[model samples]
Target: MSRFLPLTIRFADGGSMVVSSIADAKKALNGVWKDKEAPDYLAATRLVDDAVAGTCRPAVAFAAFKKAAAQQGLLKPADPSPALTMLDDLWSRKGKGPPG
Candidate 1:
Protein backbone atom coordinates (compact mmCIF):
# COMPACT_ATOMS: atom_id res chain seq x y z
CA MET A 1 0.00 0.00 0.00
CA SER A 2 3.00 2.27 -0.24
CA ARG A 3 2.63 5.19 -2.58
CA PHE A 4 6.30 5.54 -3.34
CA LEU A 5 8.00 4.50 -6.55
CA PRO A 6 10.96 2.18 -6.45
CA LEU A 7 14.23 3.96 -5.74
CA THR A 8 17.63 2.76 -6.87
CA ILE A 9 20.44 3.02 -4.37
CA ARG A 10 23.98 2.54 -5.65
CA PHE A 11 26.63 1.76 -3.10
CA ALA A 12 30.20 2.95 -3.13
CA ASP A 13 31.31 -0.67 -3.46
CA GLY A 14 29.47 -0.92 -6.81
CA GLY A 15 26.50 -2.81 -5.42
CA SER A 16 22.92 -1.59 -5.84
CA MET A 17 19.37 -2.12 -4.58
CA VAL A 18 15.88 -1.13 -5.53
CA VAL A 19 13.73 -0.03 -2.64
CA SER A 20 9.96 -0.18 -3.13
CA SER A 21 8.71 1.10 0.19
CA ILE A 22 9.68 3.39 3.03
CA ALA A 23 10.73 0.34 5.00
CA ASP A 24 13.04 -0.73 2.23
CA ALA A 25 14.36 2.80 1.91
CA LYS A 26 15.13 2.91 5.61
CA LYS A 27 17.05 -0.35 5.37
CA ALA A 28 19.00 0.89 2.38
CA LEU A 29 19.65 4.21 4.09
CA ASN A 30 21.10 2.50 7.12
CA GLY A 31 23.02 -0.19 5.26
CA VAL A 32 24.51 2.05 2.59
CA TRP A 33 25.01 5.39 4.33
CA LYS A 34 27.85 6.32 6.63
CA ASP A 35 27.07 9.98 7.21
CA LYS A 36 24.59 9.81 10.02
CA GLU A 37 25.12 13.51 10.70
CA ALA A 38 24.12 14.71 7.26
CA PRO A 39 21.04 16.94 7.26
CA ASP A 40 19.32 15.20 4.41
CA TYR A 41 20.04 11.80 5.90
CA LEU A 42 18.31 12.74 9.13
CA ALA A 43 15.39 14.25 7.30
CA ALA A 44 14.99 11.16 5.13
CA THR A 45 14.80 8.93 8.18
CA ARG A 46 11.94 10.96 9.62
CA LEU A 47 10.16 11.43 6.31
CA VAL A 48 10.39 7.78 5.36
CA ASP A 49 8.76 6.74 8.59
CA ASP A 50 6.04 9.33 8.32
CA ALA A 51 5.41 8.39 4.71
CA VAL A 52 4.83 4.77 5.64
CA ALA A 53 2.27 5.81 8.22
CA GLY A 54 0.52 8.02 5.66
CA THR A 55 1.34 11.11 7.66
CA CYS A 56 3.37 12.66 4.86
CA ARG A 57 3.61 12.57 1.10
CA PRO A 58 5.59 9.68 -0.29
CA ALA A 59 7.14 12.06 -2.79
CA VAL A 60 8.58 14.07 0.06
CA ALA A 61 10.20 10.99 1.46
CA PHE A 62 11.40 9.94 -1.97
CA ALA A 63 13.06 13.28 -2.57
CA ALA A 64 14.67 13.28 0.84
CA PHE A 65 15.89 9.73 0.38
CA LYS A 66 17.46 10.54 -2.96
CA LYS A 67 19.09 13.66 -1.58
CA ALA A 68 20.49 11.72 1.32
CA ALA A 69 21.84 9.06 -1.02
CA ALA A 70 23.44 11.72 -3.18
CA GLN A 71 24.99 13.43 -0.17
CA GLN A 72 26.55 10.16 0.93
CA GLY A 73 27.77 9.42 -2.58
CA LEU A 74 25.50 6.37 -2.60
CA LEU A 75 23.61 7.52 -5.68
CA LYS A 76 24.96 6.74 -9.11
CA PRO A 77 24.47 8.94 -12.12
CA ALA A 78 21.71 7.67 -14.34
CA ASP A 79 22.73 6.06 -17.61
CA PRO A 80 22.54 8.28 -20.66
CA SER A 81 19.54 7.66 -22.86
CA PRO A 82 20.00 5.75 -26.13
CA ALA A 83 19.12 8.76 -28.24
CA LEU A 84 21.70 10.90 -26.49
CA THR A 85 24.32 8.20 -26.94
CA MET A 86 23.52 8.04 -30.61
CA LEU A 87 23.95 11.79 -30.90
CA ASP A 88 27.35 11.59 -29.28
CA ASP A 89 28.45 8.82 -31.64
CA LEU A 90 27.29 10.73 -34.67
CA TRP A 91 29.09 13.87 -33.55
CA SER A 92 32.31 11.99 -32.95
CA ARG A 93 32.35 10.65 -36.53
CA LYS A 94 31.20 13.82 -38.22
CA GLY A 95 34.59 15.35 -39.12
CA LYS A 96 37.08 12.82 -37.90
CA GLY A 97 39.44 11.13 -40.34
CA PRO A 98 39.20 7.35 -40.60
CA PRO A 99 42.23 5.02 -40.49
CA GLY A 100 45.32 7.14 -40.00
Candidate 2:
Protein backbone atom coordinates (compact mmCIF):
# COMPACT_ATOMS: atom_id res chain seq x y z
CA MET A 1 0.00 0.00 0.00
CA SER A 2 1.10 3.59 -0.57
CA ARG A 3 2.65 5.03 2.56
CA PHE A 4 0.81 8.34 2.15
CA LEU A 5 -2.77 8.19 3.34
CA PRO A 6 -5.34 10.76 2.34
CA LEU A 7 -7.06 12.86 4.99
CA THR A 8 -10.81 12.37 5.01
CA ILE A 9 -13.66 14.51 6.30
CA ARG A 10 -17.32 13.52 6.61
CA PHE A 11 -20.24 15.92 6.56
CA ALA A 12 -23.62 15.78 8.22
CA ASP A 13 -25.29 15.39 4.85
CA GLY A 14 -23.69 11.97 4.38
CA GLY A 15 -21.14 13.49 2.03
CA SER A 16 -17.42 13.00 2.38
CA MET A 17 -14.15 13.96 0.75
CA VAL A 18 -10.45 13.49 1.00
CA VAL A 19 -7.34 15.69 0.76
CA SER A 20 -4.28 13.77 -0.32
CA SER A 21 -1.57 16.18 0.73
CA ILE A 22 -0.55 19.74 1.61
CA ALA A 23 -0.49 20.62 -2.08
CA ASP A 24 -4.03 19.38 -2.52
CA ALA A 25 -5.22 21.39 0.45
CA LYS A 26 -3.51 24.48 -0.92
CA LYS A 27 -5.19 24.00 -4.26
CA ALA A 28 -8.55 23.87 -2.49
CA LEU A 29 -7.80 27.29 -1.04
CA ASN A 30 -8.50 29.22 -4.19
CA GLY A 31 -6.53 32.46 -4.74
CA VAL A 32 -3.89 31.49 -2.22
CA TRP A 33 -0.51 32.66 -3.43
CA LYS A 34 1.91 29.74 -3.71
CA ASP A 35 4.83 31.69 -2.30
CA LYS A 36 5.94 33.22 1.01
CA GLU A 37 3.65 36.19 0.40
CA ALA A 38 0.85 34.11 1.96
CA PRO A 39 1.64 33.20 5.54
CA ASP A 40 -1.83 31.74 6.09
CA TYR A 41 -1.21 29.41 3.22
CA LEU A 42 2.11 28.34 4.64
CA ALA A 43 0.67 27.89 8.13
CA ALA A 44 -2.21 25.80 6.88
CA THR A 45 0.13 23.69 4.80
CA ARG A 46 2.33 23.07 7.81
CA LEU A 47 -0.66 22.21 9.99
CA VAL A 48 -1.95 19.66 7.51
CA ASP A 49 1.49 18.23 6.98
CA ASP A 50 2.16 17.90 10.69
CA ALA A 51 -1.21 16.28 11.25
CA VAL A 52 -0.63 13.81 8.45
CA ALA A 53 2.82 13.12 9.83
CA GLY A 54 1.27 12.33 13.25
CA THR A 55 3.01 15.25 14.94
CA CYS A 56 -0.16 17.29 15.52
CA ARG A 57 -3.68 16.59 16.73
CA PRO A 58 -5.92 15.26 13.99
CA ALA A 59 -8.76 17.40 15.33
CA VAL A 60 -6.66 20.52 14.85
CA ALA A 61 -5.80 19.62 11.30
CA PHE A 62 -9.36 18.58 10.60
CA ALA A 63 -10.57 21.92 11.85
CA ALA A 64 -8.26 23.67 9.40
CA PHE A 65 -9.46 21.35 6.66
CA LYS A 66 -13.07 22.13 7.47
CA LYS A 67 -12.40 25.87 7.30
CA ALA A 68 -10.76 25.54 3.89
CA ALA A 69 -13.52 23.29 2.59
CA ALA A 70 -16.18 25.70 3.77
CA GLN A 71 -14.39 28.62 2.16
CA GLN A 72 -14.32 26.66 -1.09
CA GLY A 73 -18.09 26.08 -0.79
CA LEU A 74 -17.52 22.36 -0.40
CA LEU A 75 -18.80 22.11 3.18
CA LYS A 76 -21.87 23.26 4.99
CA PRO A 77 -21.90 25.17 8.24
CA ALA A 78 -20.54 23.01 11.03
CA ASP A 79 -22.64 22.29 14.05
CA PRO A 80 -21.34 23.16 17.46
CA SER A 81 -19.36 20.46 19.21
CA PRO A 82 -21.35 18.25 21.57
CA ALA A 83 -19.46 19.57 24.57
CA LEU A 84 -20.13 23.16 23.57
CA THR A 85 -23.78 22.43 23.04
CA MET A 86 -24.04 20.83 26.47
CA LEU A 87 -22.31 23.79 28.05
CA ASP A 88 -24.72 26.20 26.36
CA ASP A 89 -27.66 24.21 27.63
CA LEU A 90 -26.25 24.23 31.15
CA TRP A 91 -25.63 27.98 31.14
CA SER A 92 -29.13 28.67 29.91
CA ARG A 93 -30.51 26.84 32.96
CA LYS A 94 -28.00 28.08 35.54
CA GLY A 95 -30.44 30.61 37.02
CA LYS A 96 -33.16 27.99 37.26
CA GLY A 97 -32.64 24.56 38.78
CA PRO A 98 -30.34 21.61 38.27
CA PRO A 99 -30.68 19.88 34.90
CA GLY A 100 -33.30 17.21 34.99
Judged by lDDT, which candidate is best?
1
Please list the residue runs of candidate 1 whose C-alpha ends up more than 4 Å from where it truly belongs after superposition: 1-7, 12-14, 82-100
lDDT value for model 2: 0.55
Q: Residue pairs in steric clash, candidate 1?
A: none
Query: Taking the tens digit of each residue's C-alpha lDDT, what string does model 1 give over 1-100?
Result: 6566556787756778887677788788767466777888899999988988899998888888888887787876667778988877887789654434
| lDDT at position 78, candidate 2 | 54
Clash counts for the predictions, in order: 0, 0
Tens digits of lDDT, candidate 2, 1-100: 3223454544334555555555555444433222333454456667878876889876666567555555444543456778988887887778654458
- Worst lDDT run of 10 residues, candidate 2, spans 29-38
| TM-score leader | 1
